[model samples]
Target: MGPELHYQMIISRTAELRTEAADHRRVRQVEAAKKERSEGGLRRSLFGKFSAA
Candidate 1:
């Protein structure tokens, strides 16, 4: 293959890799937020019951 074509291919591949990495990072952040929210809710519920009783 020619140098120009090879360069273009490399650039396209790099862009794809970067996009995949960003998507993975965003998904991880969402999962972490969900976990934190659930844990927080559990803590609040426990405390609320004890206080009410």
Candidate 2:
């Protein structure tokens, strides 16, 4: 293969890998936010019940 073609292929592959990594990071951030919210709700509910006593 020509050097120019090889260089282009390398650049394209790098871009694809970067996009995939960003997507994975975004998904993890969303999941973490959901988990934090759920845990916070659970804590509030538990304390609310105890505080009533």
Candidate 3:
């Protein structure tokens, strides 16, 4: 019973760590996409102003 309980605890802890790492990766991907979009918008605005002038 003691060894079985310890094994279960290790499994659960490993699963939690996996989930946290996946979440961190997903967040970084989302932030990178957003930064790219904003930069693209800035470039378009600048080009539009030059064209208008």
The sequence of per-residue lDDT tens digits that candidate 3 reaches over residues 1-53 is 69999999999999999999999999999999999999999999999999999
lDDT of 2 at 50: 100
Clashing pairs in 1: none
TM-score on alpha carbons, each prediction: 0.86, 0.88, 0.71
Cα lDDT tens digits, model 1, 2-49, are: 999999999999999999999999999999999999999999999999
Error of 2 at 47 (Å): 1.0
**After TM-score superposition, what is the CA distance of residue 50 in candidate 3 from its true location, in Å?**
4.1
Each prediction's whole-model lDDT (CA) = 1.00, 1.00, 0.99
> Candidate 2's residue-wise lDDT over 1-53, tens digit each?
99999999999999999999999999999999999999999999999999998
- Number of clashing pairs per prediction, in order: 0, 0, 0
Superposing all C-alpha atoms, what RMSD in Å does each candidate have to the true structure? Answer: 1.1, 1.0, 2.1
How far residue 22's Cα lies from its native spot in candidate 1, in Å, is: 0.7
